[model samples]
Target chain A: MSMPALLDLYRVQARMAVQQQLQYRMRNAMVLVGFLTEPVVYLAVWTAVAKENGGSVGGWTSGTLAAYFIVWTLVRSMNVVFTPYGFEWRIRTGQMSASLLRPRHPVHYDLAYFAGSKVVWFVMWLPIAAALALLFRPTLRPEAVEVLVFVVAIVGAYLIRSLLQWLIGMVTFWTTRVGALFEIYMVAELMLSGRLVPMSLMPSWVRDVAGWLPFKWTFGFPIEVLVGDLGTRALLLGLATQAAWIAATAGLLALAWRGAVRRYSAVGN
Target chain B: MRALRLIALHLRVVAMYEMQYRMNFFLQLFQSALATGTGLVVLALVYAQVDELRGWSRPELLVVLGVFTIIGGVLESVVKPNLVRFMEEVADGRLDFVLAKPVDAQLLISIRAVRFWQAVDVLVGAVVLGVGASRLTPRPGALAVLGFAAGLLFAVVILYSFLLILATSAFWFVRVDSFVETFDGVFQAGRWPIGIYPGWLRTGLTVVVPVGFAVTVPAELLTDRSGWVTLAAEAALAAALAGLARLCWRLGLRRYGGASA
Candidate 1:
C-alpha cells in the first residue's frame, strides 16, 4: 500500500509539471530539433565515410550506422536531466535549504521532475523516429527479448546520468563557477558518451576509456543493445557493469549531498 | 565611424559588467583546450579509418574545423548572447529601451553583450588554420588566400543575418530561447565539409542554414579557390540575406510597437 501511494504521489507531481511546462511548449518544441540534429548529422557524415571506405568501417555499414543514430534519438530523449546547470541557483537562492526540509530525498524530487519533463519530448519523438526509420533503411532485426533488455538498460543509464548530474550540482556548495565547470564536463561527455560517433568507430583508446566509463552506459549501451550487437554473455556483462556503476555513483551522490547540505547557508554566509 | 566608436565604448561597458563576476578564466582556458583537443581527436579518429573524408584530406578538414571554431567564437562573443538577451527582452516587454536608442536596433542588438572569454576560440582557430595551412601540399596561392578572406567575411555576414532573423521571430513567438540552440545543432554540420553530406542535407545546409557558405566553401576557397562562381554567388547572397534580416527586424519592430504601444 505504501509503495502504491508513493507511486500515486509521483504521478500527481508529473501531472503538475506537465501543466507548468505548457507555458514553455514552444521552447521544448524548438529543443526537439537539437535532439534530432546532432545524431542525424553524425549519421550523414559517417555514412559518407562508410561510402568512401567501400560501404563499411569498423564493422558497421551505412545502414547499421543509421540504425545506431535512430536509436540515439530515443536514448537521448530518455536521458533528459539538465538539473546540474540549475543547482547553483537552487543553493544561491536558498531553494536547497527548503528542499532539505522535505521528507523525500532530493534525488526522488529530481527524478520525478526529469520523468515529468521528458514526457512531451518522449511522446513527440515517436513520429520523428518513425520518419527517420523509413528514410535511413537501417538494418534492425532485434528479437523481442533484446528490445525488453534495451528498455532496462536505458533505465539504468538514466539513473547514472542523473545521479552524476546531481553530484555535479553539489559543486555549488564550493564554487559559483558551476556553469564553466559544467561546460568542461559536457565536452568530455560529448566524446565519451558516443554522442559524436560510434564507439567502435572511435579510436581504440577512446573505446577503451569509454568502455570503463559511465558516460557510454548512458547513451551507447542502450543503442548497442538495440543494434543487437551483443551476444548473451556480453549482454549480461554489460548490464552488470552498468548496474555496478549506477550503484557506485548513487553512493557517491549520497555522500556529496550530505556534505553539500551541511555547508548550505541560507543567510548567504 | 560612429558605429565603431559606439562599439568601442560598449565593449568597455560589457567588459566592466563581466568583470564583476569572480573569474576562473583559467578554467575557461582549460575548457577551450579540451574542446579543441576533442575536436582534433575526433578528426584523427575519422581519418584513421579512411585516407580522406569525401576528398578532403586531414589538413583541409583541419582548416574547416578552424573556420568552424572562429565562427562559433564570434557568434558566442557577440551575435548569440545579444540575440538571446534581446529575445528575453521581447518576451518580457523590455525591448523598448533598446529600440529607443539612437543607433540602429539591429546594430544595437548585435553589440549588446560580449563574453570576452570566447576570444580563446578565435585564437585557437587561427593557430589551427596556420598549422593546417603549413601542411597543405604546394600551399595556397595568393588568390586562394584572397578568396578565403572574402568568403569568410561573407560567411560572417550570412550567419549574423540568419541569427538576427531567428531572434527577431521572438517578436512573434515571444519565447524562443531554445530556437537558437537548434541553430547551433544545425551549425555543427559546418564542422565537416558540406559535400560529405547526401544531396538533400547538403542543400539544406547550404540554402536552409547557410553553414556551407559559412565554413565549407570558405575552406574550399583556401584549399583550391576553384569555385569562383559559387564564391561570387555567395557574396551576393550575403548582401541579400543581410537585407532580408534588416527587413525582418523592421517588420518585427513595427508589430512589436503596435502591440505594446
Candidate 2:
C-alpha cells in the first residue's frame, strides 16, 4: 500500500477505537484515574524531597518538579499500552480468530483503540493539571524552540515505548506465563524510566545505564526536555536514539508477528 | 471451632491447586522481589541526594517499606483474592450456594479462595525488615518486638476491615470493582511515611484512607518512636472499623434476601 493510504487507514482506525472506548465510559474513567495516581504520588514525593533539600535538588526546585510531573502525567497517559495479559486470554478464548478475520491487521485496531482512549484521558487530565499548577505554583519557562522540540520528543517517546511493550506482549504467543516477565519489565521501567524517581537523583552508574537503555528515552528524556535540562546536542542525540530504538523494535515486532501467526494453533475450540 | 477447621481445610485445597502450578511460585517470588526492589532503590536514590527526608533516615524509611510490604502481602494472600471472588459471587447470585452451606456464610465467602503463592510476599517482606533492622544503631529489644507484633496485628485488622467494608459494598453497587481500584490507588500513597505529606494529605491518608495506620504506625513502633497512647488509638480505630464492617455486611445480606420489601 502507498504511504498516504496507510496513513488514512490509521486515521480511520483511530477514530473507531476512540468511539469504542467512549462506549465504556466508566471503565475508561477508572483506568484514567489509576494512571493519574502514580505520577501524582511521584510528584508529591519529589516535591517534598526538593522542599526539604533547601528547595532544589539536581536542578529541580519543588515548582519545577511539579511542572515536570504534571507534564509527565500527560505524556505518560498518552503512552499507556495494554499489557499482554489480555492477549493470552484472547488467544486461549478464540478472540484471535475474530481479529484475524477483520479487514485490517489486529495491530491497527489496537493502535486505533490506544489513540481513541488517550484522547478521552487527555481531556480528563487537563483540569487535574490546571489544579496542580495552581496549587503547586510551578515555575515553567520554556522557549518556543524548546516547546517544539519537547512535543516532537514526546511523540517519539510514546511510539517507542508502545512498540517496545507491544513486542513484549507478543511473547504470549510462545509462553502462557509471561506475567513474571511483564512484572520485571514494569519494575525496571519504574526505576529506569524515572517513573519512581527522576534519573537525575539515581546513582551515577544507574543513570548511565538508564541513558544507554531505551527506557530512559521513553520517560526521562521527554521530562528532561520540558524541564530545560536537555541542551541542543543532547536533544538531537535523544531523538536519534529514540528513532533508532523505534526502528529496531518495529522490525522485531514484524518478525514476531509472522512467527506467532505461523505457530498459531487455536486453543480450545 | 469447627468453622475454623473448615476454613483451614478450604485453604489446604487452594494450596494444593496453587502448588500444582509450580511456575506460579517463581512468578510470585519474582514479582515480590521486583516490587520490593523498586521501592528500596527509590529510597536509596532519594537518600543519596539528601541525608534525611523529613527526619527519616534511610534505614527508618526501609523499615516503613518493610512493614508496607508485609501488610500488603497479608492483604493479597488472604483478603484480596477471597474478597474479589466474593464480590463476583454477590453480583452473579452464586453467593446463594455459599450462603446455603452449613458454615457461616460470611466466614466461608471471606476466606474462600486462598492464593498461597502470595506468601512469597510475606517472606520477602520479612527479609527486608531483617535487613533494615540490621542497619539500625540500637537494636530493637524485647519491648520493641512486642510492640511491633501488636502493631502488625493492629495493622492487619485495619486492612481486613477495610477490605470487608469495601467488598460488602458489592451487594449494593454491583459494579464496585472500581471502588477496589480506587482503594488500591490510595493505598500506594502508604509507601512513604505519612508525616512527609502536607497536613491536608496527612489527614486524608490517616483518617479517610487509613494508609498510614496500616504500615507507618507499625514501623514507628518497631523503631521505638510510637507511644502506647498512639498504639491504643490505632487498635481502637481498627476495632471500630471492623465492627462497622460487620454491621454493613449484615445489612447487605438482609438486602440480598429482599428483607427491605
Q: Could you give the C-alpha RMSD of every candidate to the true structure, in order shown? A: 2.2, 2.4
lDDT of 2 by residue, A26-82 (tens): 776766666666776787778778888788888888878887887788778877765
Indicate the residue-level lDDT of A59 in model 2: 82
List model 1 lDDT by residue over A1-269, tens digit each. 37787787688777777777777766777778766778887898889889999999888898899999999999988998856667888777777778788777767777877778667777778888898988888998998878988989988888888988888888988875487768767877888888778777776787888877789888888898989568888788888988999899999988887887777777343
lDDT string for model 1 (B1-261, tens) is 999999999999977776776354566667777878878988887888889888989999899989988888888778888888888888888888887789887888888788887777888888888899889997998988999989888999999999888888888877677878888878877888888787877888888888765888789889994579878988998999999999998899888953264
Candidate 1 residue B113 C-alpha distance from true site, Å: 1.5
The local lDDT score (0 to 100) that residue B56 gets in candidate 2 is 83
Give the Å shift of residue B242 in candidate 2: 0.7
Error of 1 at B256 (Å): 2.1
In candidate 1, residue B135 scores what lDDT?
95
DockQ for candidate 1, C-alpha atoms: 0.70
Q: Estimate TM-scores for all models.
A: 0.94, 0.94
| Model 2 bad stretches (over 4 Å) | A1-8, A229-233, B257-261
**Pairs that clash in candidate 2:** none
| Residues B1-261, model 2: lDDT tens digits | 898898889988988888789987877897898898888878877886788888788888888888888888988898888899988888888888887778778788778887898989999998898888888768888888888889999999998898899889888877678767877777788888888876777888888779776788888888887878778988899889999989999999987843222
